[model samples]
Target: MEITAEEMKKSIEKIYERLDEVSPVDFDCGKLCGEVCCKDLEGEGELALYLLPGEELMYEESDEFELYYIDSSEIKYPHSWKGQIYLVKCVNPPRCDRSIRPIQCRTFPLIPHITKNGEFHLIFDETEFPYECPIVRDHIKLNHDFLKVTYEIWMKLITNPLVYDLIDMDSRMRDNRKTNYEIVV
Candidate 1:
Protein backbone atom coordinates (compact mmCIF):
# COMPACT_ATOMS: atom_id res chain seq x y z
CA MET A 1 0.00 0.00 0.00
CA GLU A 2 1.39 3.35 -1.03
CA ILE A 3 0.84 6.35 1.27
CA THR A 4 0.12 9.56 -0.63
CA ALA A 5 1.79 12.87 0.09
CA GLU A 6 -1.64 14.34 0.94
CA GLU A 7 -2.26 11.60 3.50
CA MET A 8 1.19 12.20 4.90
CA LYS A 9 0.39 15.88 5.33
CA LYS A 10 -2.84 15.27 7.19
CA SER A 11 -1.24 12.67 9.44
CA ILE A 12 1.44 15.20 10.25
CA GLU A 13 -1.19 17.78 11.24
CA LYS A 14 -2.96 15.37 13.59
CA ILE A 15 0.34 14.55 15.27
CA TYR A 16 1.11 18.22 15.80
CA GLU A 17 -2.25 18.74 17.46
CA ARG A 18 -1.37 16.00 19.94
CA LEU A 19 1.65 17.96 21.01
CA ASP A 20 -0.59 20.50 22.69
CA GLU A 21 -2.00 17.85 25.04
CA VAL A 22 1.34 17.20 26.71
CA SER A 23 1.96 18.57 30.23
CA PRO A 24 5.23 20.27 30.98
CA VAL A 25 7.52 19.18 33.83
CA ASP A 26 10.49 20.77 35.58
CA PHE A 27 14.01 19.33 36.18
CA ASP A 28 17.66 20.35 35.87
CA CYS A 29 21.08 18.91 34.96
CA GLY A 30 24.33 20.56 35.84
CA LYS A 31 25.91 21.26 32.44
CA LEU A 32 25.79 18.03 30.37
CA CYS A 33 29.34 17.18 29.31
CA GLY A 34 29.58 15.87 25.73
CA GLU A 35 29.80 16.85 22.07
CA VAL A 36 26.95 14.95 20.29
CA CYS A 37 25.46 11.53 20.77
CA CYS A 38 24.11 10.25 17.46
CA LYS A 39 24.45 6.44 17.58
CA ASP A 40 25.53 4.64 20.75
CA LEU A 41 22.40 2.58 20.82
CA GLU A 42 23.91 -0.85 21.41
CA GLY A 43 20.60 -2.60 20.77
CA GLU A 44 18.51 0.01 18.98
CA GLY A 45 18.69 -1.76 15.67
CA GLU A 46 20.44 -0.23 12.65
CA LEU A 47 21.62 3.35 13.09
CA ALA A 48 19.17 5.13 10.80
CA LEU A 49 18.62 8.82 10.08
CA TYR A 50 15.12 10.26 10.29
CA LEU A 51 14.17 13.65 8.87
CA LEU A 52 11.93 15.86 10.93
CA PRO A 53 8.67 17.10 9.46
CA GLY A 54 9.10 20.41 7.64
CA GLU A 55 12.74 20.25 8.66
CA GLU A 56 13.54 19.50 5.05
CA LEU A 57 16.37 21.93 5.44
CA MET A 58 18.20 19.04 7.13
CA TYR A 59 18.97 17.60 3.72
CA GLU A 60 17.20 19.23 0.77
CA GLU A 61 18.07 22.77 1.80
CA SER A 62 21.63 21.81 2.70
CA ASP A 63 24.52 22.17 0.29
CA GLU A 64 27.27 20.48 2.31
CA PHE A 65 27.03 16.96 3.79
CA GLU A 66 28.54 13.54 3.48
CA LEU A 67 26.82 10.16 3.68
CA TYR A 68 28.13 7.42 6.02
CA TYR A 69 27.93 3.71 5.27
CA ILE A 70 27.61 0.61 7.43
CA ASP A 71 30.69 -1.53 7.68
CA SER A 72 29.67 -5.16 7.22
CA SER A 73 33.12 -6.15 8.34
CA GLU A 74 32.42 -4.78 11.79
CA ILE A 75 31.25 -7.71 13.86
CA LYS A 76 27.71 -7.42 15.11
CA TYR A 77 27.76 -6.40 18.74
CA PRO A 78 26.68 -9.21 21.08
CA HIS A 79 22.95 -8.67 20.82
CA SER A 80 19.86 -10.70 20.03
CA TRP A 81 16.88 -10.35 17.73
CA LYS A 82 13.79 -12.57 18.25
CA GLY A 83 16.14 -15.19 19.76
CA GLN A 84 19.36 -14.81 17.79
CA ILE A 85 22.30 -12.42 17.78
CA TYR A 86 22.81 -9.96 14.92
CA LEU A 87 25.06 -7.04 14.33
CA VAL A 88 23.07 -4.51 12.29
CA LYS A 89 25.08 -2.27 10.03
CA CYS A 90 24.49 0.83 7.93
CA VAL A 91 25.86 -0.18 4.54
CA ASN A 92 24.92 3.07 2.88
CA PRO A 93 26.13 6.15 4.68
CA PRO A 94 25.68 7.92 1.38
CA ARG A 95 21.91 7.49 1.62
CA CYS A 96 20.65 7.10 5.18
CA ASP A 97 16.88 6.71 5.26
CA ARG A 98 15.41 9.70 7.05
CA SER A 99 12.73 7.42 8.48
CA ILE A 100 14.69 4.36 9.63
CA ARG A 101 16.99 6.38 11.90
CA PRO A 102 17.08 5.26 15.53
CA ILE A 103 14.71 7.20 17.82
CA GLN A 104 17.69 8.33 19.93
CA CYS A 105 19.33 9.97 16.94
CA ARG A 106 16.10 11.68 15.91
CA THR A 107 15.43 12.91 19.45
CA PHE A 108 19.09 13.33 20.29
CA PRO A 109 19.47 13.73 24.05
CA LEU A 110 16.17 15.57 24.11
CA ILE A 111 14.04 12.40 23.62
CA PRO A 112 10.58 13.99 23.40
CA HIS A 113 7.63 11.86 22.37
CA ILE A 114 3.80 11.88 22.26
CA THR A 115 1.61 9.11 23.57
CA LYS A 116 -1.36 7.48 21.84
CA ASN A 117 -3.54 10.08 23.56
CA GLY A 118 -1.60 13.02 22.16
CA GLU A 119 0.25 13.67 25.38
CA PHE A 120 3.77 15.04 25.16
CA HIS A 121 6.52 13.73 27.46
CA LEU A 122 10.22 14.24 28.01
CA ILE A 123 12.77 11.41 28.38
CA PHE A 124 16.35 11.21 29.48
CA ASP A 125 18.94 10.11 26.98
CA GLU A 126 21.08 7.20 28.11
CA THR A 127 23.80 8.61 30.35
CA GLU A 128 25.96 5.62 29.49
CA PHE A 129 25.89 6.56 25.82
CA PRO A 130 29.45 7.47 24.79
CA TYR A 131 28.73 9.82 21.90
CA GLU A 132 29.84 13.42 22.26
CA CYS A 133 27.00 15.26 20.55
CA PRO A 134 27.27 19.04 20.90
CA ILE A 135 23.60 19.57 20.19
CA VAL A 136 22.80 17.52 23.31
CA ARG A 137 24.55 19.93 25.67
CA ASP A 138 23.71 23.05 23.66
CA HIS A 139 20.36 23.12 25.49
CA ILE A 140 19.55 21.22 28.68
CA LYS A 141 16.51 22.04 30.77
CA LEU A 142 13.15 20.72 31.96
CA ASN A 143 11.81 23.04 29.28
CA HIS A 144 13.25 20.85 26.56
CA ASP A 145 13.20 23.14 23.55
CA PHE A 146 15.41 20.80 21.56
CA LEU A 147 13.10 17.90 22.31
CA LYS A 148 10.19 19.74 20.73
CA VAL A 149 11.97 19.78 17.40
CA THR A 150 12.63 16.05 17.56
CA TYR A 151 9.18 15.14 18.87
CA GLU A 152 7.72 17.20 16.08
CA ILE A 153 9.46 14.89 13.69
CA TRP A 154 7.98 11.82 15.36
CA MET A 155 4.61 13.52 15.48
CA LYS A 156 4.76 13.86 11.73
CA LEU A 157 5.66 10.21 11.30
CA ILE A 158 2.94 8.83 13.58
CA THR A 159 0.26 11.28 12.47
CA ASN A 160 1.17 10.68 8.86
CA PRO A 161 1.60 6.95 9.46
CA LEU A 162 5.02 7.31 7.91
CA VAL A 163 5.97 3.66 8.37
CA TYR A 164 2.41 2.41 7.80
CA ASP A 165 3.48 -0.38 10.16
CA LEU A 166 5.13 -0.72 13.56
CA ILE A 167 8.31 -1.82 11.81
CA ASP A 168 10.93 -3.97 13.53
CA MET A 169 11.56 -3.07 17.16
CA ASP A 170 13.88 -5.66 18.71
CA SER A 171 12.55 -4.81 22.08
CA ARG A 172 13.88 -1.90 20.06
CA MET A 173 14.27 0.28 23.11
CA ARG A 174 14.51 -1.99 26.14
CA ASP A 175 15.51 0.25 29.10
CA ASN A 176 15.12 3.32 26.89
CA ARG A 177 12.14 4.64 28.80
CA LYS A 178 12.09 8.34 29.63
CA THR A 179 10.99 9.80 32.95
CA ASN A 180 7.76 10.76 31.10
CA TYR A 181 7.13 14.27 32.44
CA GLU A 182 3.90 15.25 30.74
CA ILE A 183 4.10 18.55 28.89
CA VAL A 184 0.51 18.93 27.61
CA VAL A 185 -1.41 15.99 29.02
Candidate 2:
Protein backbone atom coordinates (compact mmCIF):
# COMPACT_ATOMS: atom_id res chain seq x y z
CA MET A 1 0.00 0.00 0.00
CA GLU A 2 1.35 3.46 -0.85
CA ILE A 3 -0.16 4.89 2.34
CA THR A 4 1.68 4.21 5.57
CA ALA A 5 -0.19 2.75 8.53
CA GLU A 6 0.26 6.00 10.42
CA GLU A 7 -1.32 7.95 7.58
CA MET A 8 -4.24 5.55 7.46
CA LYS A 9 -4.74 5.86 11.20
CA LYS A 10 -4.78 9.63 11.01
CA SER A 11 -7.19 9.63 8.09
CA ILE A 12 -9.51 7.20 9.88
CA GLU A 13 -9.52 9.37 12.97
CA LYS A 14 -10.24 12.52 11.00
CA ILE A 15 -13.02 10.87 8.99
CA TYR A 16 -14.68 9.50 12.09
CA GLU A 17 -14.57 12.90 13.74
CA ARG A 18 -16.41 14.39 10.81
CA LEU A 19 -19.04 11.66 10.35
CA ASP A 20 -19.73 11.02 14.02
CA GLU A 21 -21.49 14.35 14.26
CA VAL A 22 -24.41 13.68 11.91
CA SER A 23 -26.45 10.98 10.24
CA PRO A 24 -28.23 10.80 6.87
CA VAL A 25 -31.30 12.12 8.55
CA ASP A 26 -32.52 13.19 11.98
CA PHE A 27 -34.24 9.81 12.48
CA ASP A 28 -32.89 6.36 11.96
CA CYS A 29 -33.08 5.67 8.24
CA GLY A 30 -32.94 2.00 8.97
CA LYS A 31 -36.31 2.09 10.65
CA LEU A 32 -37.89 2.99 7.34
CA CYS A 33 -36.44 0.03 5.49
CA GLY A 34 -35.69 -2.48 8.25
CA GLU A 35 -31.93 -1.90 8.07
CA VAL A 36 -31.97 -3.43 4.61
CA CYS A 37 -28.61 -2.09 3.47
CA CYS A 38 -26.84 -3.86 6.29
CA LYS A 39 -28.14 -7.30 5.46
CA ASP A 40 -27.79 -9.87 2.70
CA LEU A 41 -30.80 -9.54 0.48
CA GLU A 42 -32.76 -12.51 -0.87
CA GLY A 43 -30.66 -13.92 -3.78
CA GLU A 44 -27.77 -11.54 -3.85
CA GLY A 45 -24.53 -12.95 -2.52
CA GLU A 46 -23.51 -12.13 1.05
CA LEU A 47 -22.96 -8.45 1.50
CA ALA A 48 -19.34 -7.39 1.79
CA LEU A 49 -17.96 -3.92 2.34
CA TYR A 50 -14.69 -3.25 0.54
CA LEU A 51 -12.29 -1.10 2.46
CA LEU A 52 -10.63 1.80 0.77
CA PRO A 53 -6.92 1.47 0.10
CA GLY A 54 -5.10 1.56 3.46
CA GLU A 55 -8.38 1.37 5.42
CA GLU A 56 -7.47 -2.08 6.75
CA LEU A 57 -5.06 -0.41 9.16
CA MET A 58 -8.02 0.69 11.24
CA TYR A 59 -9.08 -2.92 11.89
CA GLU A 60 -5.70 -4.45 12.69
CA GLU A 61 -6.85 -5.36 16.20
CA SER A 62 -10.55 -5.96 15.65
CA ASP A 63 -11.94 -9.48 15.79
CA GLU A 64 -15.52 -8.54 15.02
CA PHE A 65 -15.03 -8.62 11.26
CA GLU A 66 -14.25 -11.25 8.67
CA LEU A 67 -11.70 -9.79 6.28
CA TYR A 68 -10.89 -11.00 2.80
CA TYR A 69 -7.91 -9.84 0.76
CA ILE A 70 -8.58 -9.58 -2.96
CA ASP A 71 -5.99 -8.85 -5.61
CA SER A 72 -6.98 -5.73 -7.46
CA SER A 73 -5.64 -7.19 -10.69
CA GLU A 74 -8.03 -10.13 -10.46
CA ILE A 75 -11.01 -7.92 -9.84
CA LYS A 76 -12.59 -4.97 -11.60
CA TYR A 77 -10.73 -2.09 -10.01
CA PRO A 78 -9.31 1.19 -11.12
CA HIS A 79 -6.32 0.67 -13.38
CA SER A 80 -4.20 2.54 -10.93
CA TRP A 81 -4.99 0.04 -8.20
CA LYS A 82 -2.40 -2.68 -7.93
CA GLY A 83 -1.88 -5.39 -5.29
CA GLN A 84 -4.75 -6.16 -2.91
CA ILE A 85 -7.53 -4.54 -0.92
CA TYR A 86 -9.56 -5.61 2.10
CA LEU A 87 -13.18 -6.69 1.99
CA VAL A 88 -14.85 -6.73 5.39
CA LYS A 89 -18.06 -8.41 6.46
CA CYS A 90 -19.47 -7.61 9.85
CA VAL A 91 -20.33 -10.75 11.75
CA ASN A 92 -23.38 -9.21 13.35
CA PRO A 93 -24.49 -6.36 11.18
CA PRO A 94 -27.56 -5.03 12.95
CA ARG A 95 -25.97 -5.22 16.35
CA CYS A 96 -22.45 -4.05 15.60
CA ASP A 97 -21.33 -1.03 17.55
CA ARG A 98 -21.95 1.99 15.38
CA SER A 99 -19.20 3.95 17.08
CA ILE A 100 -16.61 1.64 15.50
CA ARG A 101 -18.13 1.02 12.08
CA PRO A 102 -15.81 1.07 9.09
CA ILE A 103 -15.41 4.06 6.80
CA GLN A 104 -17.53 2.40 4.13
CA CYS A 105 -20.39 2.01 6.57
CA ARG A 106 -20.21 5.64 7.60
CA THR A 107 -20.19 6.88 4.03
CA PHE A 108 -23.08 4.80 2.79
CA PRO A 109 -25.98 6.30 0.72
CA LEU A 110 -23.48 9.00 -0.27
CA ILE A 111 -20.57 8.41 -2.61
CA PRO A 112 -17.60 10.54 -3.62
CA HIS A 113 -17.24 12.00 -7.07
CA ILE A 114 -14.56 14.12 -8.76
CA THR A 115 -15.57 16.10 -11.81
CA LYS A 116 -13.38 16.43 -14.90
CA ASN A 117 -12.46 19.91 -13.73
CA GLY A 118 -10.98 18.50 -10.49
CA GLU A 119 -13.73 19.27 -8.03
CA PHE A 120 -15.28 17.17 -5.29
CA HIS A 121 -18.97 16.42 -4.83
CA LEU A 122 -21.26 13.99 -3.00
CA ILE A 123 -24.02 12.03 -4.71
CA PHE A 124 -26.59 9.44 -3.81
CA ASP A 125 -24.89 6.09 -4.18
CA GLU A 126 -26.42 4.53 -7.31
CA THR A 127 -24.48 1.30 -7.30
CA GLU A 128 -26.42 -1.96 -7.39
CA PHE A 129 -26.77 -2.38 -3.67
CA PRO A 130 -28.30 -5.58 -2.32
CA TYR A 131 -31.09 -3.79 -0.49
CA GLU A 132 -32.86 -0.52 -1.14
CA CYS A 133 -32.09 2.58 0.87
CA PRO A 134 -35.13 4.71 1.60
CA ILE A 135 -33.09 7.88 1.63
CA VAL A 136 -31.92 7.36 -1.92
CA ARG A 137 -35.14 5.77 -3.18
CA ASP A 138 -37.39 8.49 -1.85
CA HIS A 139 -35.15 11.47 -2.42
CA ILE A 140 -35.10 12.26 1.27
CA LYS A 141 -33.27 15.32 2.34
CA LEU A 142 -30.09 14.50 4.19
CA ASN A 143 -28.78 16.49 7.08
CA HIS A 144 -26.88 19.46 5.65
CA ASP A 145 -24.08 18.99 8.13
CA PHE A 146 -23.71 15.39 7.03
CA LEU A 147 -23.35 16.42 3.41
CA LYS A 148 -20.84 19.15 4.24
CA VAL A 149 -18.57 16.98 6.36
CA THR A 150 -18.70 13.94 4.08
CA TYR A 151 -17.72 16.08 1.12
CA GLU A 152 -14.92 17.71 3.09
CA ILE A 153 -13.48 14.37 4.18
CA TRP A 154 -13.67 12.99 0.64
CA MET A 155 -11.79 16.00 -0.69
CA LYS A 156 -9.02 15.27 1.76
CA LEU A 157 -9.09 11.56 1.00
CA ILE A 158 -8.74 12.10 -2.76
CA THR A 159 -5.42 13.78 -2.15
CA ASN A 160 -4.12 10.21 -2.06
CA PRO A 161 -3.48 9.29 -5.68
CA LEU A 162 -4.97 5.83 -5.47
CA VAL A 163 -8.09 7.17 -3.82
CA TYR A 164 -8.38 9.88 -6.44
CA ASP A 165 -8.01 7.35 -9.25
CA LEU A 166 -10.62 5.08 -7.75
CA ILE A 167 -13.24 7.80 -7.46
CA ASP A 168 -12.26 9.37 -10.73
CA MET A 169 -12.51 6.09 -12.56
CA ASP A 170 -15.94 5.39 -11.08
CA SER A 171 -17.10 8.91 -11.87
CA ARG A 172 -15.99 8.61 -15.45
CA MET A 173 -17.70 5.28 -15.82
CA ARG A 174 -20.92 6.65 -14.37
CA ASP A 175 -20.75 9.55 -16.78
CA ASN A 176 -20.15 7.29 -19.73
CA ARG A 177 -23.18 5.20 -18.76
CA LYS A 178 -25.26 8.28 -18.03
CA THR A 179 -26.45 7.12 -14.63
CA ASN A 180 -28.54 9.87 -13.11
CA TYR A 181 -27.22 10.16 -9.58
CA GLU A 182 -28.56 13.10 -7.65
CA ILE A 183 -25.83 15.63 -6.88
CA VAL A 184 -26.23 16.32 -3.17
CA VAL A 185 -23.37 18.82 -3.06
Candidate 3:
Protein backbone atom coordinates (compact mmCIF):
# COMPACT_ATOMS: atom_id res chain seq x y z
CA MET A 1 0.00 0.00 0.00
CA GLU A 2 1.14 3.51 -0.70
CA ILE A 3 2.08 5.47 2.38
CA THR A 4 -0.38 8.24 3.17
CA ALA A 5 0.81 11.85 3.06
CA GLU A 6 0.30 12.24 6.79
CA GLU A 7 2.42 9.14 7.51
CA MET A 8 5.13 10.30 5.18
CA LYS A 9 5.21 13.75 6.76
CA LYS A 10 5.59 12.34 10.25
CA SER A 11 8.34 9.99 9.11
CA ILE A 12 10.20 12.81 7.41
CA GLU A 13 9.90 15.09 10.41
CA LYS A 14 11.23 12.38 12.69
CA ILE A 15 14.08 11.80 10.29
CA TYR A 16 14.95 15.49 10.33
CA GLU A 17 14.96 15.54 14.10
CA ARG A 18 17.15 12.46 14.29
CA LEU A 19 19.67 13.87 11.83
CA ASP A 20 19.64 17.44 13.15
CA GLU A 21 23.01 17.27 14.87
CA VAL A 22 24.65 14.39 13.03
CA SER A 23 27.04 15.19 10.23
CA PRO A 24 29.65 13.31 8.20
CA VAL A 25 32.38 15.11 10.12
CA ASP A 26 32.81 17.01 13.36
CA PHE A 27 33.28 20.28 11.46
CA ASP A 28 31.41 21.62 8.46
CA CYS A 29 32.62 19.48 5.58
CA GLY A 30 31.11 22.04 3.20
CA LYS A 31 34.04 24.34 3.97
CA LEU A 32 36.38 21.72 2.58
CA CYS A 33 34.49 21.32 -0.71
CA GLY A 34 33.42 24.96 -1.07
CA GLU A 35 29.90 23.60 -0.64
CA VAL A 36 30.07 22.12 -4.10
CA CYS A 37 27.13 19.89 -3.29
CA CYS A 38 24.96 22.90 -2.62
CA LYS A 39 26.15 25.14 -5.44
CA ASP A 40 23.45 26.68 -7.59
CA LEU A 41 24.54 25.70 -11.06
CA GLU A 42 22.43 28.40 -12.64
CA GLY A 43 23.62 28.16 -16.23
CA GLU A 44 25.58 24.95 -16.06
CA GLY A 45 22.52 22.69 -15.59
CA GLU A 46 19.55 22.17 -13.32
CA LEU A 47 21.01 21.73 -9.85
CA ALA A 48 18.13 19.86 -8.28
CA LEU A 49 17.45 17.02 -5.90
CA TYR A 50 14.64 14.46 -6.29
CA LEU A 51 12.25 14.19 -3.41
CA LEU A 52 11.27 10.79 -2.14
CA PRO A 53 7.65 9.69 -2.50
CA GLY A 54 5.33 12.05 -0.63
CA GLU A 55 8.24 14.25 0.46
CA GLU A 56 6.64 17.14 -1.40
CA LEU A 57 4.26 17.44 1.51
CA MET A 58 7.00 19.10 3.50
CA TYR A 59 7.56 21.84 0.99
CA GLU A 60 5.55 24.71 -0.50
CA GLU A 61 6.11 27.33 -3.16
CA SER A 62 8.81 29.51 -1.62
CA ASP A 63 11.59 31.86 -2.58
CA GLU A 64 14.12 29.61 -0.91
CA PHE A 65 13.59 26.78 -3.37
CA GLU A 66 12.28 26.28 -6.86
CA LEU A 67 10.01 23.27 -6.90
CA TYR A 68 9.14 21.39 -10.03
CA TYR A 69 7.50 18.11 -10.96
CA ILE A 70 8.37 15.52 -13.56
CA ASP A 71 6.37 12.59 -14.74
CA SER A 72 7.92 9.40 -13.41
CA SER A 73 7.81 7.89 -16.91
CA GLU A 74 10.25 10.50 -18.09
CA ILE A 75 12.84 9.46 -15.51
CA LYS A 76 14.62 6.26 -14.51
CA TYR A 77 12.37 5.65 -11.58
CA PRO A 78 11.31 2.20 -10.53
CA HIS A 79 8.29 0.84 -12.40
CA SER A 80 6.30 0.91 -9.20
CA TRP A 81 6.58 4.65 -9.06
CA LYS A 82 3.77 6.43 -10.88
CA GLY A 83 2.50 9.99 -11.09
CA GLN A 84 4.72 13.03 -10.60
CA ILE A 85 8.17 13.13 -9.05
CA TYR A 86 9.07 16.27 -7.14
CA LEU A 87 12.43 17.98 -7.69
CA VAL A 88 13.74 20.97 -5.74
CA LYS A 89 16.63 23.35 -6.24
CA CYS A 90 17.84 25.88 -3.76
CA VAL A 91 17.73 29.47 -4.97
CA ASN A 92 20.69 30.35 -2.79
CA PRO A 93 23.05 27.47 -2.53
CA PRO A 94 24.76 26.47 0.71
CA ARG A 95 22.72 29.12 2.51
CA CYS A 96 19.23 27.66 2.86
CA ASP A 97 17.67 26.54 6.10
CA ARG A 98 19.72 23.52 7.09
CA SER A 99 17.05 22.15 9.43
CA ILE A 100 14.61 21.51 6.58
CA ARG A 101 17.07 20.04 4.10
CA PRO A 102 15.66 17.14 2.09
CA ILE A 103 16.48 13.55 2.90
CA GLN A 104 18.89 13.40 -0.03
CA CYS A 105 20.90 16.19 1.56
CA ARG A 106 20.65 14.73 5.03
CA THR A 107 21.92 11.33 3.80
CA PHE A 108 24.56 12.54 1.46
CA PRO A 109 27.97 10.84 0.85
CA LEU A 110 26.51 7.55 2.16
CA ILE A 111 23.83 5.83 0.10
CA PRO A 112 21.84 2.91 1.36
CA HIS A 113 22.45 -0.30 -0.53
CA ILE A 114 20.76 -3.68 -0.53
CA THR A 115 22.89 -6.50 -1.89
CA LYS A 116 21.80 -9.24 -4.26
CA ASN A 117 21.85 -11.46 -1.24
CA GLY A 118 19.45 -9.09 0.56
CA GLU A 119 22.09 -7.61 2.82
CA PHE A 120 21.66 -3.95 3.71
CA HIS A 121 24.77 -1.79 3.67
CA LEU A 122 25.78 1.85 3.54
CA ILE A 123 28.27 2.89 0.91
CA PHE A 124 29.83 6.09 -0.38
CA ASP A 125 27.51 7.58 -2.97
CA GLU A 126 29.14 7.02 -6.33
CA THR A 127 26.78 9.18 -8.36
CA GLU A 128 28.80 11.50 -10.58
CA PHE A 129 28.55 15.18 -9.81
CA PRO A 130 29.87 18.20 -11.69
CA TYR A 131 32.19 18.82 -8.74
CA GLU A 132 33.94 16.49 -6.34
CA CYS A 133 32.93 16.10 -2.70
CA PRO A 134 36.06 16.10 -0.58
CA ILE A 135 34.57 13.72 1.95
CA VAL A 136 33.81 11.05 -0.63
CA ARG A 137 36.97 11.56 -2.72
CA ASP A 138 39.27 11.57 0.31
CA HIS A 139 37.66 8.51 1.91
CA ILE A 140 37.23 10.55 5.05
CA LYS A 141 35.94 8.57 7.96
CA LEU A 142 32.38 9.67 8.77
CA ASN A 143 31.42 10.34 12.34
CA HIS A 144 30.23 7.16 14.06
CA ASP A 145 26.99 8.69 15.29
CA PHE A 146 26.20 10.08 11.88
CA LEU A 147 26.60 6.73 10.21
CA LYS A 148 24.62 4.96 12.91
CA VAL A 149 21.68 7.33 12.80
CA THR A 150 21.62 7.52 9.03
CA TYR A 151 21.56 3.77 8.82
CA GLU A 152 18.74 3.65 11.32
CA ILE A 153 16.74 6.21 9.38
CA TRP A 154 17.17 4.34 6.11
CA MET A 155 16.14 1.11 7.73
CA LYS A 156 12.91 2.71 8.83
CA LEU A 157 12.36 4.37 5.46
CA ILE A 158 12.71 1.21 3.43
CA THR A 159 9.83 -0.29 5.35
CA ASN A 160 7.59 1.66 3.01
CA PRO A 161 7.27 -0.37 -0.17
CA LEU A 162 7.83 2.56 -2.48
CA VAL A 163 11.14 3.44 -0.82
CA TYR A 164 12.16 -0.22 -0.84
CA ASP A 165 11.44 -0.52 -4.55
CA LEU A 166 13.55 2.54 -5.31
CA ILE A 167 16.53 1.36 -3.31
CA ASP A 168 16.21 -2.21 -4.58
CA MET A 169 16.07 -1.01 -8.16
CA ASP A 170 19.29 0.94 -7.69
CA SER A 171 20.92 -2.00 -5.92
CA ARG A 172 19.97 -4.39 -8.72
CA MET A 173 21.44 -2.05 -11.28
CA ARG A 174 24.69 -1.89 -9.36
CA ASP A 175 24.79 -5.65 -9.11
CA ASN A 176 24.11 -6.04 -12.82
CA ARG A 177 26.99 -3.68 -13.60
CA LYS A 178 29.29 -5.24 -10.99
CA THR A 179 29.87 -1.78 -9.59
CA ASN A 180 32.54 -1.70 -6.93
CA TYR A 181 31.76 0.34 -3.83
CA GLU A 182 33.21 0.72 -0.36
CA ILE A 183 30.72 -0.51 2.26
CA VAL A 184 30.66 1.69 5.38
CA VAL A 185 28.14 -0.35 7.37
Best by TM-score: 3
lDDT by residue for model 3 (119-169), tens = 899999988788888888899999999999999989988987888999999
Residue ranges of candidate 1 with Cα displaced over 4 Å = 1-63, 68-106, 112-122, 132-140, 144-153, 162-185
Q: Which RMSD values do the candidates have, in order?
A: 10.0, 1.9, 1.7
lDDT of 2 by residue, 28-134 (tens): 88899998877766688778888887777766776776778889888878888888878878777776667667776787789998777877789889787766788
User: What's the CA RMSD of model 3 in angstroms?
Assistant: 1.7
lDDT of 1: 0.38
Residues 108-174, model 1: lDDT tens digits: 4545444454454544443444445333334334344444555565544545332312211211232
RMSD of 1: 10.0
> Where does model 3 exceed 4 Å of error?
1-4
Write the candidate numbers in order of decreasing TM-score.
3, 2, 1
Compared to the true structure, candidate 3 yields what TM-score? 0.93
lDDT of 2 at 41: 65
Among all candidates shown, the one with the greatest lDDT: 3
> Which run of 10 residues does model 1 get worst, by summed lDDT?
162-171
